[model samples]
Target: MKVLLIGPAGSGKSLLTRSLGEWLRRGGYSVALVNLDPACGYLPYKPDFDIRSFYDIRKIMRKEKLGPNAAVIRVHELLSNNLEKILPELKIERDFILIDTSGQMELFVFRETGPKIVEALKDAVGIFLVDATLMNPIDLVTLKLMAQVVRLRLNVPVVPVITKVDLVPEINFANSAQLTREIRKQKGSVVDLALALNKSLDGFDIPVRVIKISSKTCEGFGELLSTLYETYCECGDLT
Candidate 1:
């Protein structure tokens, strides 16, 4: 099973990738971890295949007389063309493969190169995460909007996850509880928004799972693993 972990910057995608890798291994599965960040300075776990081998945005921009933004665009193009070349080098014997993608959400998810990479892998799963701290009405609405974009472009199963639940408890307990109470009070507003978002999706029945994982306490790790296993099995990626 190949899974892609995607989220905005500072959304804990890398840490989740590492934790998931360990979890899969403990379940008797060999896993390969790949870092797709071309400009990443350091990674907590070594990647089997890194995009830096093909293109480094900063270095390429300097050599080609391009600005930083242009450099990143060029890097994307290079990866698109060279994706096949790198795939052969990957040993896919592992039962699970976790890909750590760039924090540049739009660059990868909506762009041509991003879609091509997903096509190169068989039975790929897309795990899109939203920071729990960003769980406000307006932001949740925007997230659903982006989910539509991803669904339209990618042909893989998209799993939406709420991350950084550690911050949930830290959120003003009074304010958080009050919001929940308000949600209960104003079910018309809150529940209506959720229902509308679900109606907008193709598979409205696939409920969004909330995972409050802490690399610190390993909280919610079990739930996350169970969800991932069931998801993969249901998608026929796991036997």
Candidate 2:
């Protein structure tokens, strides 16, 4: 299955891609790592297919005389235009293909490139990573909303993953009811807004199975793998 690792900058997408790919390989699964981030300077694992070889962001910045942000935008434009070039590389047989996306989440998901790329793959599942340290009830609601938006934009199945679990204490919110109660304890109009949004999201019947993992320690890898299988198969059975 093709799994796209997507999240905001510093949310551990690349690290998770590296660690997860390594774990899968060690388990005797054939995994291909694809780096789609042109602005990323260093990656923990070498991608079998790297976009920089096609469109270098630094070269775009130099040639177009654009700033860092503008150059990134230009890179996405190039990616959208030249997507056909990368599709063949992704067609090879593999048990899993883990794609690391751009660090700036908006540059990828909000742009035309993200959906186009996913449509090309046709069988891709998105793993939307949320930083565990940012998991206050209000922030969690906000992230869930963002994940929903990403799913809507891409029109694909996206699993919300909590990354950096080692940095935070155990998260024990059993359901949206627990989350709503926690939000009510906070004192702010923002908290009220979050409550309303959370309720609306619950009405949609989105099953958010929280899979927390620590890339540094490889904790929760098994649960993550099972969730991926379950998501891809659309069945409860992991086998």
Candidate 3:
């Protein structure tokens, strides 16, 4: 199974990718962690497979007189051409593959370069992580837009995840009234965003599930794991 991790910068996409890969491996699934962020200089742990072997953003920026965003776009252009070489070189023997993409969420989700990557990896599961801090209605509206972009342009099944929930324990999914009230206080109108998202996803069976996870504390990690296993794995195949 191919999984594409997409999220805004500093939204815990890389951390989740690392934690998920290690957990999957511990569960006896041979997994390959592909680092697709060429501009990313540091990783907490080494990735099993990385694209930095093909292109380095520092070099691209210096050679092309581009800013960070432009450098990322350049990396995308380079990777699109060289993906065949890159993926094969990964030598992924696992049943599942995890792609840790750039934190520039819009760079990928809203651009042709991003759609091309998803199209190239059509077999992959597309996961979009929204910061738990953005669980408010207004931010959810923005996330809904991001989700729509992923669904409409990428042609991949999208999963919405809320990260950093450990930071806020009072807002529990089990308490709908409290959650709704908190959401209203945080954002003006929860119903408005929900209605907007519902209209945008007309006829499209988008699997929208909000998962809470903290890579630091491992809070809600088990639920996240169970969700992925149930959603993506075969009958006891990758369990």
Candidate 4:
């Protein structure tokens, strides 16, 4: 079983990947933590395999004289061609493999290289983490649209996870619907924001299972695993 934790900057992908690795290990499952983020300078947990060993984004930036964004694109393009080699290094004799992805969602998600990289994994599920405390109503709308884009782009099982719920426990699946009602009754600036979002929401049809998680307190951690089991894993598999 392979689980890829993905999110924007400050969305706790690395932390959750580390925590879940520990959680699964405690449950008697052998877990291998793989860091797929070439841009990660420091990691809280030492991964069993790290992509920085092969591709260094900083080195690419300095050697090629490319900006951060351009360097990321270059590295990803190289990985897309070298996935056959990279996939072997990531493989290990473990029941569960936790993959920590780049914080830059578009650098991997929007590009063709992103899906190809994910396709290299065997039995992998993508976890999309959203920072609950930082998201506004408009951000929530954009997330829904993004969920659709990611799902369609990757053609994989994408799970929507709302992280850091301890900071703001009010946002979740209901917030999206509640915000829709609130905005319908608003005008001026609020209505203007809604109009802007409506254009982006044109073709959003992805079904999102928004589960809240607090890594600090481990609140909702069990529920998150349960949902993963029900949605992605076989019976009694990856439990």
Candidate number with greatest TM-score: 2
Report the Cα lDDT for residue 31, model 1: 89
For candidate 2, the lDDT comes to 0.83
> Residue 164 deviation, candidate 4, in Å?
0.6
> How much does candidate 1 score in TM-score?
0.80
What does candidate 3's lDDT look like per residue over 1-239, in tens digits?
Answer: 77888888988888888887777788788888888888887886588877787787888889999999989988898777776876567557677788888878777777678778777765666677887766664455456567557767777666667777787665464223343454455534556665555445443553445566777677776776666655554223322
lDDT for residue 221 in candidate 3, whole number 0-100: 64
| lDDT string, candidate 1, 33-144, tens digits | 9988776677878788777777777779779998765666678778778767777876567887889888677777867888887787766777777777877643554455
Worst 10 residues of 4 by lDDT: 230-239
User: Which residue pairs show collisions in model 1?
Assistant: none
Residue 159, model 1: lDDT of 65
lDDT per residue (tens digit) for residues 1-239 in model 2: 88988899999999998999999999999999999888999999989988888888888899999998778878878777777876787686899999999999898899887788778777777888988988887877877787778889987667778889898857756267888898989887798789889888777644666677899989889988887777777732323
* Number of the candidate with higher lDDT, 1 or 2: 2
TM-score of each: 0.80, 0.91, 0.82, 0.82
Top lDDT model: 2
Candidate 4 lDDT over residue span 57-139, tens digit each: 88899999999888888888998899888777776989878888886988888888888887777457777888888776666
Model 3: CA > 4 A from native: 141-145, 173-204, 229-239
Q: List the candidate 4 regions with Cα displacement exceeding 4 Å.
A: 172-207, 233-239
